[model samples]
Target chain A: MNNALADKALWDLRPGEAATVTGFGDALSVSYQGRVMEFGFQPGTRVQCLLNPGFGAPRVYGISNSVFSLDKEIAAAVFVTTRPPQEASS
Target chain B: MRRVLLLGSPNSGKSSLFNRLTGLSQRVANYPGITVDVASGPMVNLPDTELVDFPGTYSLEPISGEEAIAVSFLNEALADDHVSHVLCVADATRLEKCLHFILQVIRECQHHQKPVTILANMSDVIRDNQLQFDPAGLAAALGVPVISVSAKESQGFEPLVECPAEGAAPATPPSRNWRETPNEILRGTAQQLAAQFSPKGDVLINSQLRLDRFFLSTALGGLAFFFIMFLFFQSIFTWSAPVMDAVEALVSGLGEAVVPLIPNRVIADFVADALFGGVGAFLVFVPQIFVLTLVIGIMEDSGYLARAALICHRPLRVFGLTGKSFIPLLSGVACAIPAIYAARSVDSPRQRMMTYLAIPLMPCSARLPVYALLIATFISNDTILFGLVGWQGLALFFIYFFGMLVALLVTGLVSKASKNKHSEQPFVLELPPYRLPTAKPLLRNAWNRCRQFVTQAGKIILAVTMVVWVLGYFPNGGADLGESWLGTLGQFVEPVFAPLGLDWRYGIAILTSFLAREVFVGTLGTIFGIEGSEENMLPLVDHIQASGLPLGSGIALLVFFAVALQCVSTVVILAREGSTRLALSMLLSYLVGAYLLSLIAFQIVSLLF
Candidate 1:
């Protein structure tokens, strides 16, 4: 996949897909950005989408050996570059 | 005296470790942010040393009010001269995230010139998964003492207990780089250290994900959540019925055995009418409090509460609340004071306010005696499902559900009416791994909560009972209670409740209950005891039935108790936690709303029956 196609919001990844966190989106406030980072969502961190409870509910993501449930809006503010399917599977 | 500050990320088993080291039960649970306040206790072996447990936080930079409290107190404690050691607890299974926090603490401790030691908790969990964690290697790498301990099994506590006495070394000096951000540097360091020392494998996360697939799924999760809530209310009545009845029997039996021995009629009347009849009626419901606390403790310990919060988020958002509010709302079932304290965990101030509005409406245990007495009088104890369920228990369930429903509706309307429709707060909740709740700590917590209820509320109930007894007994010497001082006062308030088809006796009970919800039961017990012509004591439920109270009035009483903000402690707590204006408005509005709603309920029930 092209780099443009791989770069998207953290919420865009499906379960079993992996991504490397690039940076935060502009929509997240300065304070919330700090909070997201403090929760171990720094650049270069690997995040895996774990569970997606349907109907736009918060989805679970695994980061730094801890699981966190983030709603759609917050998840969208976290920008990540999705790895290719083969690489994610590996 | 020297002091040790116990600190860590939320759900790292920090408070539990503190309890083990200090031999104090300070309410540890599986859920994060359980300890809202700083609790200090003396170390078991070192009598002169104190161990202080701060509220859990993910970072020195706080996101919520509770974390802010932990951070602020940490700064103050580090500055205090009496502070001798800093113990940072980290989860062995999730060391990367914990190490991030540990690194922050080390930075702070180093600046303060205080010694730091890391307690890697949950050793048993890693061992169970056959995972390896080299604490010695981590200690060598981090340049601080790393002690492996299990708060659950009480293992490796000897080293932990003696760390302060041995005077563990401070962390290695910080090597700063002027270019990069400190957080980024710390994060990078934590990532590397955790990769080397943390338990290898994805066993824990994989297991948690398997459970989440079921508990957080759409259709099945909702069904399971409702079923668990139904069982919660059902068990409160079903499990405590035998214990409640035993308490009732003991009180009356003791009254029978002891009251007659007093030669003076005045003292005997005081003992029987006030002590046994009044306070004893409230005491009968203490077991129900135990059961309520026990059930909540179980849910909190099993780690299903966070999943329940996640499940509740979408629906709760409709009412301008978040899934995080679910914890405090559920804790409201046990008591509103702690529930208000728990609201600190909710990040959004607006949603926290909405949670505060909803908490007082949750059917608390204080209202249990009133509901149980009313239900026992009005609803028949018919058995169904092979006696696994009772009609009375089902009635209790509906009352609880009704309160929660009304709370949501009120928040929905208020949120819709309020301005600022676009300021949405983020909802990021951590899902702690599920663990089987141990029976010992749960039972001990339940027992301690029961004892607290008896001691804290007991004094108020006893005082109110005495005042009511004296007011009703004087002038006529118990011959005619209707002409006594309490009777006159009740008559003055009779007009207020007359619309709901209730008499002055119920009026007085409702009025006195404003002091505390359980005092309603005791107040009614005293009035009924004085009004009864027989010498032997009868159960309050029987007294209600024999008094010829209308069905509409009984239903109205239930509605009133369900809606009213009767507890003064809840009001004081709201004032302390939020604002005095919020507390007073809630108190007045709920009082009027309870009256009007109960009147409507009486009219509807009267028309139906």
Candidate 2:
């Protein structure tokens, strides 16, 4: 995947895919910004899309080997660059 | 004594490592925030050295009270002269994030001149996935000794024990130029370490995603969650019955055999009826506690519990409780005491308080015997609805359901009343990768929880039983208990309960139940002119049934027990967790609410009967 074209928000990734976190965008609720950061969601982090419970529930993501179930609202605000399936190593 | 402290980010396998080293099971699990207090034990290898396990945290910012405890304890230890080394545990599978916390620890250890070692845990996972982690490479990069160990598999601990005390300590801490944005600095450093130390592809993520597909599927996930919950609660009843029977038989047979060994009539009756009957009643429930804890431990350690919490979030949110509240609330079914302790995991005070309000009404195992005895007394044992359900079993389900309903309703009302118009706590939780729960730690944890319950609550129960025994035994000397000192007290409270068709005997039982709910059955057995051993439950029920007591009164008592905050231990915990006022107000409101509701139900049932 081309790095320039690959940059997309976290919610853009499908389940079973992986990505590198670019940066946390400001679209997330103010209350969750501190928490998302505290939980290791930041630029240069590697994350994989784990699960999205249907009916618009929070999407679960694996970042830095820790699983975090993020609300779709918050997931949409986290920016990332989608990595190719084979090279998506932490 | 020199102290070797085990430190790590939450859920980073620190407690498991501590347990492996110390041989003391200090509550290790997959979920974060299990250890809320400091635990110290003598190391097995270095017997002269003490090992301490601290609560987990992501950063030193200390967002919650438990995190504050961990950070402050570490700060204090850094200033202490006797502390020898700090062992930082990092998950090998998640080294990037673990490195961030390890870097912070390195900085602090450098400042204090204390030796530090990094234990990269979960090496078994790395090995299983055919991935390699260069612990030596990372260790070289940081100027610290890093040992690869799998606490679960019990591998790679020899080097840890043989680790030298005079090992490398960095001459200086990392530069603080990037301290303003700690995550950025940590992230950059973590990225560098990951590139050099870890393998080229993710393995666990794929397996975890495949598992989550089925477990977190909307339709199937909800069904699985409920199925597991039902099995757990059912097992508590079905699995415990035989053991309860055995305990009952031993106590009753001992009472019959041993009372004659005493010559004096008064002492004989005391030994046979009071001591054996009263205490044995509480002991019968021990097996059930074991089952409840074991099931919960499995669910928690296997990583299925987080999914249950996720599934419960939307539904529970409607009642103003976050998904995080589910563990404590479900745990409340076993015992409210630990459930209250588990509520500390909730970051939001408002949500936690709401959970606390809902907990007491969860129809704990303490109330099981009381419900069983009462239902058996009045309801027919035969199956109903063309053998679809037993009347007694349905009654049990309804009683539990009734309590849960009231808990949710109260939480909803209180959430509305509370003044948290702003700052809703987000439910961003780690959905830990599924693993086969190791039974060694799970059973050990369950055993510890059971032991804790027996030691802590048993003291109170035994004391209350003996007091009630003494109150009824003396003055008239075990003859005509209605004329005893307890009788006078019972009469004083009798008027308060007369509206529900109960006499002073039942009134006294109700009062004693305030100490603990299961005591109600024993108290009733004593008052009904029989030994209070569960072996005599049938006889006690027969006595009440033969007395022509109104059906409405039996149902009313069940209702009262369901809603009342009768357990003293729960009240004490509530006070400690929240405030004395909250506990007192909860007690007063529930007491009044239960009485009024029971009274109304009794009147309605009486008119129909």
Candidate 3:
């Protein structure tokens, strides 16, 4: 995880755990996987963990009315500050 | 002429509004990736106005190839003064999320001095939920006309059409750095706006979350996906069979009744053999085409296809295709022409090219008639294994499976050889909330697709059938086909297929079939003096069975058609969509591969039998 995320990776987020995006880690940088940014993954976004495929694979996250599934490696690159479970209204 | 550009995020009901405004039955699906190309038609009520529907995109920044297309089109429209207005469509149910794109549209319009309007689509959802949409507040904030309309229910469109033609430029340009805008800021602003409009926030999200808990679950979702696919393919066979039978019987009955009416013997033979035997053979597959399109349309409109793609992505990635490739590949089973067009949704050019290479190998509807005829002719219907599975059904399933396997193998090989394999895009797709599909659009789209397939393929099929009929009817005037001009041509190619234990007649059929795979059955029927209809299929089967062709050769023919790129329309689509080089290379490689593999299968089976 990026140092800016306080060592938090998005893949570690559980369902109903809301988080505020800090910045893209090395993998999701424009020089690397630019699509991560294109998919509305910019900083200060609120994302709630929706579902995990349950095989140590990708997990689905709901952010700004869009549901996106990201693999473990790419999910790990999305650094965020975890919001308390109570903050997730849905 | 007034040109109005309609823009929206995917699945925002943008297409429905276009359909309503233009009175055109444009394809409206529940998923995000349906409209890859722009569809344009004149507005129904406004004769001087034209509406263009663009592919949905999340942002102006280009991530995928389709998004790039959308972004460039918007840029072009902004620069061009002839475009009178830009209409940004937003989903009323998901207003908070949709505002992100709408804001970008407003900013871009401001910079270009183009007038913009916000079309609040899906107002019926708001009405059903008893929620409010404050068009006045939204209008004040955006400094543009905000129109709330239900494109599906056909309400609130009058305000849209009655709006003035002269687009007033914004008095003050809104200055916001789109690239640097924080997602939290946009989400918060959108939420505040939504709250201002509706007293309750998150009403839609809560409903969606309750459903997603089960639909997005790991095991249940996977099981449901497979079950749906199995039911879909099986229904294509079972549901379409009766309709197919009816069509076949009608064609044969017509041929029998009409052939004797012609006074000239040669013309009579031509009418029966060429027109009825040739073109009629291809018409039987139309029912299957309708069934395939209808099923796919429902799956798309119900929002299940996106989930299926999500599940298949992991498996498809292993084969060098993205989960996005699934829709197009499945569509290929119905027809390769539209499948090639659908492939434009794939983000990566390399993967798209690989997909094109695999599409022709799909056991399309064109191959179904040939497969049925061959399987019925060679394999006994009573040859049941385990007393539960009929040999015929099993053979059909195996052929489809075989084609899919070859498609995957070819895609994998091409990916391995591709130069940009290292820099592949990450798999990212948006899953929309589930909605019940309407029957009106489903049947209409299905009918439109069936019509498209027939009209596009009809000309080529007819011309080829006529030419084959002429060659066979000439040089001897209804004498033995063995001494006819077609026989001379068939003899020339006989040695090529002789290794497969086929005679000159079969060679002639194979040659004619190059125009379209279904023509194989028609040419064979004509050569054997039978109309290519369902009633005559059994007689053709009997003739082939008694003709002394080895069992191995029959299986060889089946295997060959299953693997080959035999359809001219498929090749034409490949050339048009991708490149002539790609199409030519695919044709050459598959032709060689089909011949060699069939040869090996024939030789081994001959030895065993």
Clash pairs for candidate 1 = none
The models' CA-based lDDT, in order, is 0.79, 0.77, 0.74
**CAPRI accuracy category, model 1:** medium
Instruction: Summing lDDT over every window of 10 consecutive residues in candidate 1 chain B, give the lowest-scoring window.
Output: B172-181
Candidate 2: segments with Cα more than 4 A from true spot: A1-34, A44-46, A55-57, A72-90, B24-35, B164-184, B191-198, B248-274, B334-352, B365-369, B372-397, B419-423, B515-555, B568-585, B603-609
TM-score of every candidate: 0.81, 0.84, 0.83
Most DockQ-accurate candidate: 1
DockQ of 3: 0.40
Clashing pairs in 2: none
- Candidate 1 lDDT at B420 equals 69
> By the lDDT metric, which is better: model 1 or model 2?
1
| Best-performing candidate as measured by TM-score | 2
lDDT of 1 by residue, B1-609 (tens): 899889998889886788788886454322233335566778888878888888778888776555676577688889998998899999988886788788888788877877888889998988888889888778776767788899999898776667675566433333332223387677778767765776777778898888888888888887888898888767776787899889999999999999999999999999998899878877786777677767777887789878887888998998889988987887688667667766866766778899999999998878888887788889889989999999989999999999988899888988888846345677888888898887776787677766755665577667777887898788788775567887788899898888898899888788767767877776687777743322222377788888898899998999999999997667866876677899999999988988899989999999999
For model 2, state the Cα shift of residue B335 in Å: 4.4
True contacts kept of 2: 0.44
Residues B187-284, candidate 3, lDDT per residue (tens digit)?
A: 45654565455324556667777776677677777777778878876767678889988998899899999998899998888889767876776677
Among these predictions, the greatest lDDT belongs to 1
